[model samples]
Structures are given as structure tokens and as C-alpha cells.
Target: MTSKPVIIVTGADLAPEALALLGDYEVAFAGRTPQAADLVALARKHNPVGMIVRYGSVTAEVMDAAPALKVISKHGTGTDTIDKAAAQARGITVTAAAGANAAAVAEHALALMLACAKSVVKLDARMHAGHWDKATHKSLELNGLTVGLIGLGAIGRRFARMCDAIGMRVIGFDPFAADLPDYIEAVPLDKIWEASDVISLQCPLTADNKEMVNAATLARCKPGVILINTARGGLIDEAALFQAVQSGRVAAAGLDSFAREPMSAPHIFQRQPGFVLSPHIGGVTSAAYVNMGVAAATNTVAVLNSVREPAVGQQ
Candidate 1:
């Protein structure tokens, strides 16, 4: 049989076990941050029957070039990068490895909460610069604080249980989640804005809710509330967040993702007090990386082999 071709359209390569599952196929990787034109070139050259996406946008132009492309598998949960309507128009099956990385992401969310409260990054930098500065970046204890989660999906639920175990009250506004446990009491959006000492966003980025954390919402929040975002970057308005953080209205923020990838220098967040940032690695762990890779690879293979996939609540 002729070798089947598949392109990994981002920086990550599938784990060895995932690659082993595709022994019958040929694989190709596009180096990190490839231009759209370069990605289109790869599609033209490979004529791949399937594509595994991780980072960067997969536009309609790239899809149009691959005449044989039948499947597009997302390396992680977010499908916002891929042009789904365009793929569907071409009769391509789009799949994502959802919930496989929930544990890792939830752990990162907790890490951000601790980091924001304790000034982990800033203090480490202070020590590096030969200044103790312990008096300035005072730590906040979490034992009695209320944590408001924006969404109660896989990551949100895991984080909630962790907070509950630590003796913190857990509440949130998840309209989609029905029959939540006693630990997580669902509330209205207005209540989350007013009551939470720490607000962690876990909602998917919807067109209706983009930049939901804007000036209007921030004005209503309790002063000095810590903000944590391990979900989509587009969820928060960067300009409003900067002003809030600078003015001490929002005490601190821990962000694992940003509105712009490779956040530019002199951006509003630079040299700001009580804010920590990570480069979108919330779901990246030794185990989750491999699990996600395998899950996405299998999803693509299943569609190609006419094998039915288990129903997953994925976008």
C-alpha cells in the first residue's frame, strides 16, 4: 500500500507511541511560527490526507491547497485556531483531543492562583537582583478566600475540588453545567463579579463573550481581587487589565495565555507590579503532552479508517 501523508502544522511533534499508531502514514512537521504562505506550501508539497494542528492559524487557503486532506486533528482542546467552517465546507472531519489534558491544565490554574497570591515570580526576580523586598510583595493566604470559577468544565471542576480540599469556598457562573455538586454552587454572572476574592476564567472564548473582562465588569468587581486566566487569552481586555492592575483596583493577575502570542515588549504589562505571565503552556506536561498527541492522532486515524470515535463533549 502507498504511504499516507499527514502534516503536523505546528511546533509540537506527536509522541512516539502516537507515531507508532500511524505506522502506515508518512509524517511531516512545520517549524515553529511558520508563515501562512509557508504552511500553504507544505500542503501543496505533501498533499496530506490529514493534518495535526497545534499552534498558528490554519486558514482556508491552506485547506484549499490540500486536495486529498480529509481530517484535521487538534493537538489540544482549543479549535479557535482552525477554520472549522472552511474545513466543513470541504467535507473535512475536524477533531480535538479534549479532556485529555484537563488534569495538567487544572494544576496550572492552581499554580497561577498560588503564584499570584504569593508573588512567586516577582519575589524570585527580586532575590535574583539581590534585593529581599519581602516587605513589598506581601503574600495572601487562600484558606478563607472565595474562588469564583467562570466555567465548570473539566478544568474548572478539577480546580474546584482542589480549592475545596484546601478549605476555600468554591462558587461560579457556569450556565451550561447542569447538576453541579454541593462543593460548587452555581450563581449568576453579577454575583461572580461582586463576590469572588479570586476570579479564575475557565470559559471558552465565544464571539458573544470576547473581552468579557472589560472596564464595565472590572468596575463592579471587589477591589484588589486576584484574576487568574488559564483559558483563552481573548477572554480579557488587555488594556483594561493593565489600567486595573496599575491602579491597584485588581490587586494581581496570573495569566498563562495572552491576547497576542509572544507578547511584544513595552506592552501594557511590562514591569507591572503583582502580575505574573506564562507563555501559553498551561496544558504542557510530560504526561499530558504524550496523551494529547496520542488522542489527537487517534482521532484522525479513526476518521480515516472508518472507526467510530467515542462521543466527547468537544467543540
Candidate 2:
């Protein structure tokens, strides 16, 4: 209704700081758990110039509905939820707030690693049940152990540094990464499986690497190895993971993301004590919320501004 161009935020909330940056534009929220239909309706209604994706998938259908949409900015690092190919074909740029929540995600990965290594959740549950485990409990010590990181991006590098600081030998596998740190020895995927006491996934999910951690890969890992994943759920095969945990091949697993998000109850992982799960909240910290929102808004504004700018030869 307003004269200003609209920017649609997929979620109901956006940080006030982020809002301040878009004072020239009208911001509309699609509400929480926005479905594809909701996005399509919003796009048709507002014909928004930009979209900030916080939750829900942005399909090709949604993009087709918004003729004025010039850019799609992800509130976080992952852009898998956005149909990038469609955006590219439509000449609509897609961007993400990369490294906006890196520290938060890395810290969460470390916490999960510690939790798995020390049996923290199991111990807590035992204590609450009026049982003592001091006599029989033997926690794994992280010091002097080897940690293999799957990705060496902002989150992976941060986690690698944390592991290195704790006297853990750090090995990483990222063919695309450059400027190797001395402490993190660059290695291949096979070497990581064979050498690591703990394996943490920090890569984005792609067609070639979907369900990369499968039965075959698990068999290559050392027995009783620990696993931590703060990345996409599709990186690991849930069935394979279940079997490994059941067979005691994997000592413990800490998972923040799942193949199907907002993961419903009655899931297989819930029944296993060896599995520690969180509802994809690795980057849900208050600080990360503000950081991601601000970054997303900044990227959105930049793209919009560039589009509005006059060409060098123009008046």
C-alpha cells in the first residue's frame, strides 16, 4: 500500500538493527513456518523487490510469482533451501550471509563434540534417575586425539582452531580451501576416516556429496569413533548412522541438523541413547540471530542499491 518498494522477510521477526538499515523500504513478514504457497501468495500480493529467507524453501514457483524480485538473500550461510538454478535462469541474484553465524555454529560443534566424548547427556540422565555412574563410567579424553573436519570454511576453520587449542591433532579435507594453517594438516577423505578419533561435518550439501557419510564411509572409520554434525542433515545417512550406533561401531553422535527439519517425533534417532540431538539450532543464539539478520539485510540493501544505480555512461 505504501509508496516504498517492499522487502519480504520469510520469518515473522527481524532484528531491529536490521530493520533500521531498510528504512527506505517497506518490510513485510510471511510469518513462521511459511510454506511455498504462503510465499507465492505474498510475492503475488507485494511484488517485493527483495526477499530475505529465514525459514522455508523458496521454490521456482515462488520466484515466478514475483516479477519485481531482483534478489533473494539468505539469512544464514546455507542456500540449499533456495532454488539457485531457477534464480539464475530468471536473472535474479541469490546471496547468503556467509560467516554471519560461523562462531556460533563452530562453538556448538565443539560443545557437541565434548558432550559425545564425555557422555554428558547419558550421565545427566543417570543422575536424574537416582543412579551413580562414577564407578563404571569411563569418559573419553579429547586431548591428544585426532579430529577430522570435513569442511575448512569459516565454521570449520573456527572449530579446527578450537580443537587445536585443546591439544587435538587437526586434519581437514577441503579440496577447494587454500592457505593451509600449519596446525591443520590438509588430508584426503580416506585419510580422515582412517586417522580421526572424532569426525565433524561442516560442509554444505551438494548433489555429489549428499549422504556422503554412508555405510561404506562408516566402515572405513576407526571403531568407537565419535561423530558431530552441525551442518546439513543430508550429509549423513540416518539409516547408516543408526546401524553404526546400534552395532557400537560409533561410540556416540551429536546432531544439530536432520534430513527432514523441524523433525517430527517418533523418529528412529530418539530411541537411541548414543544419539544426542538438537532441533537444528546450532546457529540460533541471540548473537547469531542479530548477526545473521544484519548481514542478510546488508546484502539485500547492497544488491538493491546496485540495481538502482545509474550506469557509468548514463545521466
Candidate 3:
């Protein structure tokens, strides 16, 4: 029997090719919805050298249970669910599949932008309900509109390019980017809110950015502005957004992610007009899934073999 280092994969749906690439390691499959306690127990039994976690939080207790764990690889870009400080304290290296799902997320954001501008959701609902009300004539063309993208990271840059290609003027706000693309006019964050006809958020949610798009910011925007968020949910204040839509300050909003996941059927947005919600499927495309899964698996193997260093930043 080959005595390769054991690896535990939680909620991973890796392709055969990707799995074959990790032939030197012995992998154990853990179901997608494994309980935290069950994961801890599995970690104890497997004594895994590496772990790949998908959705659930990898708590300190779970980390403590795995005495042999050397690395924790996140299947996606977000690391907010993991206890990073605790993992660092134990000297366990953490990495994520950042930029792997950028294309899919960018595409989704653009789709949302188009849907909001065209009033697609509202029109469809009205038609399905047997209402011939032609009062939904406020649909605007996106070509000449100003698009403000918050954060010019991989996803943000891609979204900006797409917007520019469609004839929209693209403006960006990314304090970290020393130089932006020629097509994107770098502007102040507040200026983005003031001048943009459509504002799409692509920035990560941080302590400094929680509820960044609150009532105060919404009040500063142009009247009937459209908002789209494909990034973290904490960036916008939900209650404030609800009020903004109710007051007609925000013409429409397309949200793929929310403060809470698997949203309740009777959420406020369902009753609110001009609101389109998705079940966090921005990066759920087949290509994106494969890209992220392979990147995560490769990173996990690299960490175990000491071929590469852990990626910096929390996400």
C-alpha cells in the first residue's frame, strides 16, 4: 500500500483531470454539507496534511482538532468564513483561489447591469401576472450612461472593459491601483456616486467598508441611479437600500449576493418593486467552477510539497 499524505476535501466537486493531478496524495471525500463537528471528527481520524474547505466556516475548534494539518485551501476567493487569526496562530498556511472566478463574476455583474437598465425582472413579472400595464417605459439604453466601478481589481477591471466595449463611459475608484487602464478614468469614490448612472460594486467587504453604501451615500447619487453588487454583501446596508428603492432614489438594484445566504422566501426584496435578486450564482458557471476547483487543488498540493508560499491577504 502506498503511504501518501492524506488530504481531506470538504464540499469539493473536482473533475477527474484535476483529481488525477493530485495522484501523489491520498484524498478523502467529505460531503458538501458536512457539519462542523463532523468535519472536526473526520480531521481527527484522517490526520490530513491538507484540507480544502468550500462554504462553511473552518472554526478554531475545527482547526484545533487537526493536529497534522499543514494547510487550509479555500475553494473560492472569500476567506471571511475562516478563522484566520486562529489559523495563523497555529502556523497553518492559508490560501484561496483568487481571480479564478473573476471572468464569471464580471459577466454576471454586467448581466445584472443590463437587466436593471432594461427593467427585465419587473416586466417579466407583470406579464406573468396578466397585467398589460405599459407603464414600464422607463428603460434606458446603457451605451451613453456613466458606469462607476468601485475597486479596479481583476473582476473590476474586467467589468470595466466590458462596460467600455458596450459604449458606456467607465470611471473607477481603486485607491490601491497605481495606474488604471486608459479607458477607465480614475476618480474619487464620492465622485463615482455623484456622476455614475450605474454603480457596480466589485470591492471586498472590510471593517472600513461595511455598509459603505448607506443612506448617506445613496442620497448623494444621481436620482434613479441603478446599483449592482456582485461582491460581498456587507458593502451595502440592506435596510438603507430597501428604503432607497422605496423612495425611488434607486431606480433598480440587481444583487447576486446578500448579507444572508439562502434568503427566506418572504424577504422584503420579493415584495419591493425594481429589485432583482439572485442566489449568489455569480461564479456558479461550469467554467468558473472548474477553474476555481483546479486552482484550489493545485494550491493545496503546492503547499503540501513546499513548492510555493501561501497567498497574502485575508481573501
Instruction: Point out where model 1 deviates above 4 Å.
Output: 129-137, 307-315
Query: What's the distance in Å from true for residue 173, model 1?
Result: 2.0
What is the C-alpha lDDT profile of model 3 across 125-177, one tens digit per residue? 88899987676466789998899999888899999999999999999998997
lDDT of 3: 0.86
TM-scores vs. true structure, each candidate: 0.92, 0.99, 0.90
Q: What is the lDDT of candidate 1?
A: 0.87
- Candidate 2 lands at a TM-score of 0.99
> What residue runs in model 3 are displaced by over 4 Å at the alpha carbon?
1-3, 130-136, 307-315
| Candidate 3 lDDT trough over 10 residues, lowest sum | 306-315
Give Cα distance to truth, residue 225, candidate 2, Å.
Answer: 1.0
lDDT of 2 by residue, 39-84 (tens): 9999999999999999999999999999999999999999999999
Candidate 2 clashes between residue pairs 3 or more apart in a chain or in different chains:
none
> Which stretch of 10 consecutive residues in model 2 shows the poorest summed lDDT?
264-273
Clashes per prediction? 0, 0, 0
**Residue 50 local lDDT, model 2:** 98
